[model samples]
Target: MKEYFNNIYLALSTIFIGMSVTFKHLFVPAVTIQYPSVKPQLPTRERNRLYVNMDDCIGCLQCARACPVNCIEIETVKKIPDEDLGLTSNGKK
Candidate 1:
């Protein structure tokens, strides 16, 4: 009976010790930033998505066909050879 009581006391003491350590750290300074109050700086021209110019495309469907999973869906329509189309950012027709 004494040994069982000693083991319970030791377990309770250890649990309180763990809880005390957690409570002590809760008073320490936090490194967390105030979101919305502070905006994170982003590098220039950093893109998370690819944007395609349809005017620059000659209905090649190259980008759509090139995708590994075929995630890009493209609808191709025939255009007259004499029609004018804008240039790409890389100056490609």
Candidate 2:
């Protein structure tokens, strides 16, 4: 008889705890952001991809040296001093 009452009390306590959490959240406003229609602008400092500026690059292979994975492969050919390599977009040779 005592065991039966203890089991009943335990079940009622579990149900009360569960229902309290459910009711608490039921009245709260949703925090979800709707995608596609409400696109959030990313910060300017956010870097998602690597960007290489070829014009400014002197083929120094510094990136390869800094990489721990050795994934970057670079080859450079020394241009002849008199050869016109053409100007970059910013007009720098």
Residue lDDT tens for model 2, 1-93: 999999999999999999999999999997887966897789989755444577767898977876767787888989898998788768977
Q: Pick the TM-score winner.
A: 2
After superposition, which runs of candidate 2 have C-alpha atoms over 4 Å from their true positions? 1-48
Consecutive 10-residue window with the lowest summed lDDT within model 2: 47-56
* Local distance difference test, each candidate: 0.80, 0.83
Clashes of each: 0, 0
What is candidate 1's TM-score against the reference? 0.36
Give lDDT: candidate 2, residue 49. 45
TM-score for each model: 0.36, 0.39
Best by lDDT: 2
Per-residue lDDT of candidate 1, residues 1-93 (tens digit): 999999999999999999999999999997876877976667987655555776576677778876767788988777689996667768766
Candidate 2 structure lDDT: 0.83
| Root-mean-square deviation of Cα positions for candidate 2 versus the true structure, in angstroms | 17.3
Which residue pairs does candidate 2 place in steric collision? none
Which window of 10 residues has the lowest lDDT sum in candidate 1? 46-55
How much does candidate 2 score in TM-score? 0.39
How far in Å is the alpha carbon of 90 misplaced in model 1? 33
